[model samples]
Target chain A: MKRRNLLATAAMGLLLASGGAFAQGMDKVKACFVYVGPIGDGGWTFQHHQGALAVQEAYGDKVEIQWQENVPEGADAERVLTQMALGGCNIIFTTSFGYMDATNAIAAKFPDVKFEHATGYKREHPNVSTYNARFYEGRAVQGHIAGKMTKTNKIGYIASFPIPEVIMGINSYYLHAKKANPNVELSIVWAFTWFDPAKEADAAKALIDQGVDVIASHTDSTAPLAEAAKTNGAVIGFGQASDMAIPEYMPTPRVSSIIDNWAPYYVKRVGELMDGTYAQVDSWAGIKEGEVEIGMITDAVPEEVKAEAEAMRDAIAAGTYHPFTGPINKQDGSPWLAEGATAPDGDLLGMNFYVEGIVGDIPQ
Target chain B: MDFGGINPVILIATLMASAVPILLAALGETVVERAGVLNLGVEGMMVIGALGGFIVAVQTGSPVLGFIGGALAGAVLSLIFAALTQVFLANQVATGLALTLFGLGVSSLGGQGYNGIKPPPTEQLLPDALADLPVVGPIFFGHDWVVYFSIAMTAVLWWVLKATRVGLIIRAVGESHEAAHALGYKVNRIRLMCIAFGGAMAGMGGAYVSLARVPQWVDGITAGAGWIALAIVVFASWRPWRVLIGAYLFGGITVLQLNLQVAGSVIPVEYLSMAPYLITILVLVIMSAGRKANGAPAALGQNFHASR
Candidate 1:
């Protein structure tokens, strides 16, 4: 009788343990993604969706993902976010600068929900966090490639908005290009749109017509590459995003890409929440983290040129290099830094002026 | 610009393809104006059709279904314009403006999911060799069937307006609704049908933008082509042949500018980029200032109610 009683107790304990495991497995965390552009824009937001896909894959059984694309930066965004919160979204990401206010307004109303905004500065409340990438670092890589490859000493840059982010990239690209080819000149073309293939193509062609032998674009599209392909033997271009992964479109797109790896951040936060260590945080990662990557340099790049670019990339990865180092000047020919005096993070983050090697006004 | 390195055949082909959107929209508007309803909401209608067709096509993976869905979506949205102007008798201008704002919001809401992905491949009508011929091929046989349909539509519209008895009735209603009512014609009914047809065409144009041209969906995809089409109606003096010329001219400028950039023009990128829109505006101004400026249908933009 005693042995039988002990066996029954063991069986009951096993049943309870199994039930607890099942309950844990069924517990759900709701997550939502709001995008500024369509998922097929083949650029910024598309890559973010890819990161979200990674999160979905990793947390297959534990989380639910909902996404809204082409969300404008106004009251409609606020309404959609409210719907997300009401729908039981425990974590939400609003991706765009215009979404900053809406995110904060919604965050204040839903204290239980955690909010994250991409490429935005405002981080209010205990639940709000801001995140962005060091795209300028990748721009430095592009600058290096354009500088070494251009035979005309003229490089064209197709830009979107003249915002700090874009300006920082232009300055970074020109600084590095000028370092390698002292005589290199950058002609600027602003398309003023995030994703218009027609506009992007037009801007790229404008640059090509002006005798620019190499092209780089801050706008999202392979239109610039399409423009480059039309140019003569010396013309080359880089991919803004990996959307131009076609083999023939390489070399200029040589450096891989600065991928926005939001998966690690998302998963890490979720893990922290499970462990009772979650906290609101704002973060930025550059070459140190794996967010920025170097794509394969094709046979088009000369051996010595590849070696020099690789050395610079290595130094950047090892924290020994800075793209905007000493002896730089603003477009007005005023010395921005005394010889050998590097620019500070504060200045670089707020950069609005063209560097010495760049020509053309930041068209109003 | 460097068309020297680029194939002339390829350049011309791209230009004709670009003309498809404008051609579709303008042809639709020509019918609308023929019935004496001046809709400034073509842009709005086109965008909604773009979003609707794109969403359906992406969901069903059928371009035909996308086009049909787009036409229905457009017709429904136009019914709102019809109801306001027909039933409520609201100011046509204000109602059209409100319709645009409403369509933009609705499409933005409906089009959230299908962004950024490449569209499913569509079937082509012509073979490569025929498509690759020089001037004759591109201007005639190289286009998608829609291009041919648009051309055929222009001829059909011209015949319908000039030769058909139904055309006489529509023109009669447009010119003097009270007189047409005395003659036993339902002016409102005819105008309503014309408005719906206009909406469908605009929607089809929007679908073309999503399905054939860009072959992808995005927010604000139509941009401002609708507004341009509305303007072109007046610029073309409301003639079918003129509408075709205006569309190709607008389309050609856009294509030519891009080609110049590709061929390597020395112009500033900003200025060259604005070339298409600037040229369109210039043409409109020049045309409008001419002695025949008053060639628009006399009853255009005027709502008629024949209570007598």
Candidate 2:
């Protein structure tokens, strides 16, 4: 009878030990990434891939990273997400605005899986998070340089799409350019694609032929800079998603650039997942948080001009300056922001109208 | 609203450069179809050529050698399709599509480290004084050698298809492979040669985009240019000169619409972007309606069996 009592106690202890193991979760965290374009695009996807590499490097053997490139943003994205969840992925990052609906839908179906969508604003599920960089801050710096650098008093913009994010960038750039040189006339061309090198090059050529001496693009290739390089300093352009200075065309055509830094954010989120402290939240990091960065300003710009641009960058980083400070008006000439007033996040998030002096419809 | 800066001379010059890639690909497809094969892998071959040409150009610093490398890569790739469909007797349509999917994957894999690299510069073939002539100079003399090569290939193909005895054998084979086999002509051999030629031309077209026009490497750089070349072949009724005309028409519309956007014309941007595809469809409809009998080769998609 005493021996039977001891066996019963040992059985109870074994059951409790199994339960504790279940509560502690698996040994390694599986993280997956879905990219909208090939990592060789040399722009947007390439930067995101760098972030994924950082996550792997930070955790070594504790994390397993898997990614699939060139995943289209439609029904195909849903299939990919479902497969990732079934394949034991604990966290998934869908890196494009178009994947917002798919990310939210899949997150609801797999409540245990964590999702992060970039450059989007829908968060219907508790497991879904949204993150974006304040790219317009970098655009403001580009505008200041473009305004000072333009000899023709004309600046051309090659826009990708008619979304609020792109519209805001256009307004921020034009506003800062006009602030520096009131005579600067801005011309906008909507390319309607995020990554087509040939079309992007053609757009750059058309703008140059129109006598616009300064160019800026919202697209995701270095084609525009290459086109500008052909003119041998007659035309100047800024790099779009990364630093695109080919040594042969350096310091002249590609004067400055906007760089997307997503490594720290990825590492942090993965760390949270590993520590069992992961939560769904909206993360909109800017220059201050090291999300948006301005690339090297070449020596081609005058010393005073470069210094002025750097000062503006520092001020934005330190919270002393905002890109949307007003005394600004809408395209229809109505006051949008009063003097000394800054734009609210809500208004900036849904910005669809052009500011005063940008002479074109927003293409509804 | 300003059409003042839209110079006609420069417009035509840009159109000529843009048309060369499509013209070259379509012309090659014309020859392949005329030899009784429907290879839908033009896109696959073109992208492989783009990567191969860019790599060689960056490594060797010679655009000429780059074009040669691109052509050779495309031919080697097409040889795989030729063996599967010609020897193993696989379905041409399915094999062609599989080739395209395989090519896109392989090229993207090979293109990992080659992105953002520029090709060696290609200079204009004509001298400066001649190229700088007032109105005709920009239109006629300023383009690189590839543009002239496209035109030259069109003329040469036209003569080969209509005048040569070898052209007679290809036509005979395309019309009825069984009858050509009876005539002691090697049916599968001729078809293999045509497929290789088609692939080389498509590769050169892709090289033109990477080496001369946009002049950089990007994934899927030959974006849908191959499919458009296929459409041109159909609308041209497999005629080489007609293929040239169709390509130039498409190229002209593309150039004109972009210029209109910059000139600030009143048309909507979306509609202007759709203009080229819409017009191409309309032209195809009209051309098909005028020609009652089908222009496709009688034995186009059929597999051959010597024992049967």
* Each prediction's DockQ against the real complex: 0.13, 0.52
**Predicted structure with the largest DockQ when compared to the true one:** 2
Judge candidate 1 at residue A284 and give its lDDT. Answer: 72
* Global lDDT scores for all candidate models: 0.73, 0.86
Q: Please provide, for model 1 over B1-308, each residue's C-alpha lDDT reduced to its tens digit, 9 standing for 90 to 100.
A: 23554555545556666666677777777777777777778888888998888788878988888887777778788988987887667788988988887887788678776554555545456887876666667656677776677778888988898899988887777667777889998878888988888898889888877776666565667767788788777777677777777777777776665555444456655676687677776776676675764466666677877674
lDDT of 2 at B244: 85
Give per-residue CA lDDT, model 2, range B172-231, as digits (tens): 888899999998988999999999999999989888888887888888777778899999
Model 1 in CAPRI terms: which quality?
Answer: incorrect
iRMSD (Å), candidate 2: 1.6
lDDT of 2: 0.86
Model 2 / residue A11 / CA error / Å = 30
Clashing pairs in 2: none
Candidate 1: where are CA atoms >4 Å away? Answer: A1-27, A109-112, A124-126, A227-235, A247-258, A339-341, B1-20, B36-308
Best by lDDT: 2
Provide the RMSD of all predictions against the true structure, rounded to 1 decimal.
10.7, 5.7
TM-score of model 1 (CA atoms):
0.69
Per-residue CA lDDT of model 1 for A126-183, tens digit only, reads: 8899877777887888788889888889888878776777898899989889888999
